[model samples]
Target: MISLKPRWRSTLEKHRAKSARTERSGSVRLRIVAWTFLLTSFIITGLIFTVREILISDVGRGANSSTESEIGEFRNFAQIGVNPQTARPFETLEDMLGSYVTRQYTGYKEQVIGLTPHQIIFLEEQDHYALTTGYRLHQDQALLTGLRENPSNSGIEQTPAGPVHWGKVAVELRTDQGTTTGHLLVLEYIQPELDAVQHTVFIMIWVGVAGLAFTLLVSWLIATQITKPIRNLRQVAEHINDKNFSGRVTVKGDDDVAAMSHTFNKMLDRLEEATLTERQFMDEVSHELRTPITIVRGHLELMERTEEQEQTLLLVDDELERMGRIVSDLLTLAKSERPDFVQPHPTEVSELMISLDSKVQVFANHRWIIADIAEGEVGLDEQRITQAMLQLAANAAQYSPSGSAITIGSEFYGQGGERQLKLWVQDRGPGVSPEDASILFERFRRNNAKNPATAKQHSMGAGLGLAIVRSIAEAHGGGVWIAAPEDGPGSIFGISLPAPSPPKKTQSITATYPPQNEPEKS
Candidate 1:
């Protein structure tokens, strides 16, 4: 015996396991076909055997009836004491017996035997006894002896040629003297019936062989049809495991297996979508991080403790902080695919507006005012929605002048079955063009056109804020959009949430803005 390496042994074991599974599947199909053929063969063979036995029984009954009729004819002749052919009375008992024997010897298929007290004579002739065997003659003698003693004899004897149905009747010869006792024997040959049964059995054996072959062929075809779909499904699953989601099994009919294939395809679609999302996220992260990393690295390469070097350090620290925010926003967007990303609860619109108004004041020296606030409980994730609204307010403040008015508002509006909760931040700033609005909410995207207010801001953020806002809105089964105000020279960025049912009680809260004190620009 040769010893194998551990790796080789593992490979061999895996191959064997796979082969075993294949064999087991084939064996299941084979068992189905084999059992079906065997059951059909058993039923057909049983029917043939039953028919053969019934035919044999019918043959036996026919032979017995013929034997009884022959015995009755012999008794009638003996009682008349006359020649059946000549229509004349006999002078002696021997003459009457001889005449009856000669009349019965017709030289046909039937045989008759006559018995007296002294001798046994075959009525046909000596040459006609060629078909009879010694065993048959001995059985006939025994039957005659029984008739002489008891006067009623009937029996079936198994001879070398086949079976023989024989019957005997005792007769009395009546004359002027007295009556003499004689015996008459009737024999029926059953070789013809036995031959017919044998021939039929022989034919049925061939028929059974043909039937078994046909049954096996049909069973194999049916089994293949049933297992073909399952085999294809297995192959498709293997392809999917290889990260090839394009392969799909053909669904030929509305069966359970077809439904399974449909479900498998749907699973592949989800996998592909997730894979694309992950790939895009990685590409965006790498591209966005590279510029800030290069800036930090360039500043660190210069080893000097000058005032300009101190400013470079500050810029590096700011870039690092911006990078941190980008990473955090990316994580939030990624988590939007998860089921627990947003935990919704009933929140009043006025409470949300008050929270936004308080948070927006710290971002800029703008005149932050609540333009409007709607009251009513709506289902929303308080923290996530607050984060998104605050980000929009910060964006508006960044693009507007230091003393420009930034208005935050919420409202409930709809008709019939459709209802919505709309929250918006409006700013008196350089408005975004319609073309730039399309890609404004995508990751790492920013408006290239410089605003004077944005240039004055010391810390320019990495452009993931709006994208995070969109992700949060979409997580709540809603959306965010940017629109230019119809009568104003600024943009209105808003988020809309579907409110299937809102609380009936309504109230309004308006915030009074403090007196604007403009700080002189440096």
Candidate 2:
């Protein structure tokens, strides 16, 4: 089961809370801009369609008015040609025609005359020329009459100037001659539709320029309004470092960002409260557990000398020792969980090893294979280091086959201009599986079935040795790891501690003592 203590759970939650503060401001701003652009485009499209329809209606009215004016001019010219009051056709003036057309008129003298074969001829008011030239006039009128057969021939064409749409209307007219063929009236109407096309194009160009400028201005305003609050939030968040979590985003007006800022503040408040509560609880638990164990150890010593019942005395001693180990492990776990647990001090590697070896010999039946126990000093907490080393030794001794060799050693390796001491404890026993190795240091993890002798003999321990070992290593700004032994026989558990700047003289430490009496049976 993967369960966390209250302290660790709180730490993990705070880490998650701090992690949520690192979202990209640019991405958020871009989303805001995208939404604004879409909204504006929708609104503008509706407005443009409505405005275009109104412009088209105005253009249609203007075209119709211009067409009507041209039709009125055509009617005026037709009225001048054929008199509306007397219903008489007007004659063409003499000096108003071209010379090329006058030469064709052979009836008159060789003189330039405006009258051509298609010229107007008078009919009703014939107080005009008598039969003196009647014969010539008859021939001329007859020729002109044949020429005026097609009178509705004028039509407009499209050109570079404009597209001219023209139509002719038929009207009644009276001629001086008896119903002359040329006397048919013509009324034409022309409207140049292409002229309106130029105006529409000019209006569209100006409208587009104005619309583009307006859109840019509006977009800028909207982006500023949206991104300003987010930028302020970013600055406030950047100021949050490893130590600080009190800073909060400024709450502006009642917008979405303001609401988010309020939520974020509440979250930080909860996170801080949780962090403080967990730390306090861990300290309290550690003290609580340690006090009873110290009292129990005191009581065990008192009873050891006076108790007469061997079984009762043994049982009490075993229970006291077991409870002591559990309390020690709990304290180590609490210390390791703290962020500021490391307290580096110079300690001799040789002394640390010797102390561990002495303790292992007291409990283990296996022989120790020591190597590379360098005569050097490293910066570390001596007590914590010794505790970790002892746990590793005990673990190796517990799992190794009877009479197997267990190696406890240390070496010096340099890293980042500082030497580190790597302390290792290896056992030549049935090697652990990789799956088991991963969680071997976890609290209460037992990789193999307990030996029957061990189950009956040492029933007090709750398998917290390796877990405490790991916690001690972590507290000293180091780590614990397990791997298959180099010789391919067993498992190797190691701790890495930073070396001291100035080496200390190596000295032999005092010998470790086992319980004076035989360990009480469970």
Candidate 3:
């Protein structure tokens, strides 16, 4: 036997397990959302970088145009060997070049100013360069190489120098400043603005990447926090959905989730109370209906002979009688649920059996093999006991094979004077399954479809006969059960009612039932 407390605990434990499962699921969803946000950040960063690259290339090209003009003037001075100090056009040119570099650098700061030293070197090395006065300006040497190697790498061709890298521009100028035509030592190169922009691009990429990672981490945590409660609510709801209404979530705070939990628990309480009330009402209603039906049946039977309509009235009376019986059985089931339903009285077992034998004989086409009715007395409600036996007899007679015997028997059961009264109705009909037997006594339950129609046609208690039988027996502190007989064909339905205290040990009178050839009992 299982303990009731453990069963209750098991139910709660299952809900906790389910809650844990939901928490895990929430964590997984949070991870997915976090990853999605992180990926989006990366994509956006890439797009920004691409757009800035294009803009820088365009700006660099414009700056390169001015730088090229300045370089031409410097070259004209160099060709004439006129010092830059005395070169008038060259002096204007030098100032223009310096201003252009400074302006370009300042403008680029608005987009990507935090270029690392390594990135600056990498950017400058993208091109080729030439030194002024045959001496390399350490700061400008890298620019010479970059201009020679990466003409178009700067996203512009405003200068003409070396490789066709984007944004690159280069210019060839005459070394003689005053000379209109002279040998122009090709000393053109890319501007430092292109190198600065590339360096800034690298620095911005790192910063954006770090920011994206931090954003993703925060987003994941937030998503997890939000969805955790939702998942808990889902799991608890599922438990209730599965009929485990005792479960409740832990209300952490006065958030929406807590409010929802409170509401859910309240709903469960109402549902439980309503369910109990409805069951009580049904029981009371079913029980009350029986008394009126019985009274109606008795009244209808009394009116049977007095009606003057003869045969038609008789048929109507029969139908009315069937309906009355069905209602009475339904009421009996209801009554069984009451605390006062059990009202046992002293009744001789022998006398009850004799009465039952005679009554059931009217419905039997085959003989009833009734065991000797012991002369002992037991406590039982006389009317209810009779009703139960009649239902059993009716069931056997209606469903059994033609002329098959129904054995009604009683025997002593239990040890140490724990007396039990056993009454069984056995028939050689198809047996019910173990699973079906569990619910055989439920109201409106039919064993199979075949008999439901027949029972309806006969108005035979609305399929509640067996249910009433079980209910009555249980009300008398007993249980009824059905199973296949081990001896061979058919089913055996039996009730084991508590025997009367101080059981009478009297002898019984056996009643033998021989085989019958007639269609009806005589």
User: Largest lDDT belongs to which candidate?
Assistant: 1
**Per-model TM-score versus the true fold:** 0.48, 0.49, 0.39
Q: Model 2, 420-522: lDDT tens per residue?
A: 7778888766666655665667777766644444454335667678777766775665666665544557767787666645645799976545544667566
Of the pair 2 and 3, which is ahead by TM-score? 2
Candidate 2 ranges beyond 4 A from true positions: 1-26, 41-61, 72-168, 171-267, 301-322, 336-340, 344-522
- Worst 10-residue lDDT window, candidate 1: 1-10
Candidate 3 whole-model C-alpha lDDT, 0 to 1: 0.59
Ranking the candidates on lDDT from highest down gives 1, 3, 2
TM-score of 2: 0.49
Tell me how far the alpha carbon of residue 492 in candidate 3 is from the true structure, in angstroms, after superposition: 21
Residue-wise C-alpha lDDT for candidate 1, range 340-397, written one tens digit per residue: 8899999887888888888888975789878778788888999999999998988887
lDDT of 1 at 223: 87
RMSD of 2: 18.4
